[model samples]
Target: MSSAQWNAGQAHGEAQAKTEEWVKSAQNTANKACDKMADSRESAQHGKEQSAGFIQQGAIDGVKNTLGINEKK
Candidate 1:
């Protein structure tokens, strides 16, 4: 094979390798970002549930107090 042809082939191979490497790196970054977002969503949902529970308990206590059913603590 001609030297020019060999050089072209080597350059193409190098370019392909770099492209594949970049794709893998990008996918890894995206996966990590997605996982982090999922974790945040779950944490937010849990916080909302806890806040709702507190609100419900407070409402119950308020009603009892209004009805003069306060339990001695």
Candidate 2:
């Protein structure tokens, strides 16, 4: 085979390898982003639950105080 033909084949092979490597890297990055989003969603849900509990407790305390249900003797 001629040198120019052999060189062209080698260049094509190298380009294909680089393209495969880039695709794998992009997939890895996308997976990581999805994992972080899931984690953030869980954290936000937990915070909402905690805030609801606190508000419920405060409402109960307000009702008791209004009725003088637990006034000090």
Best by TM-score: 1
Candidate 1, run of 10 with poorest lDDT = 64-73
TM-score of 1: 0.95
**Could you tell me the TM-score of candidate 2?**
0.88
Candidate 1 lDDT over 8-70, as tens digits, reads 999999999999999999999999999999999999999999999999999999999999897
For each candidate in the order shown, give its overall lDDT on alpha carbons: 0.97, 0.95
lDDT of 1: 0.97
Instruction: Please provide TM-scores, in order, for all candidate models, with all chains considered together.
Output: 0.95, 0.88
Write down the lDDT that model 2 would get: 0.95
Query: Which portions of model 2 miss their true places by more than 4 Å?
Result: 71-73
How far does residue 35 in candidate 1 sit from its true spot (Å)?
Answer: 0.3
RMSD of each: 0.9, 1.9
How far does residue 29 in candidate 2 sit from its true spot (Å)? 0.6
- Which runs in model 1 stand beyond 4 Å of their true positions? none
For 36-63, candidate 2 gives per-residue lDDT tens digits of: 9999999999999999999998888889
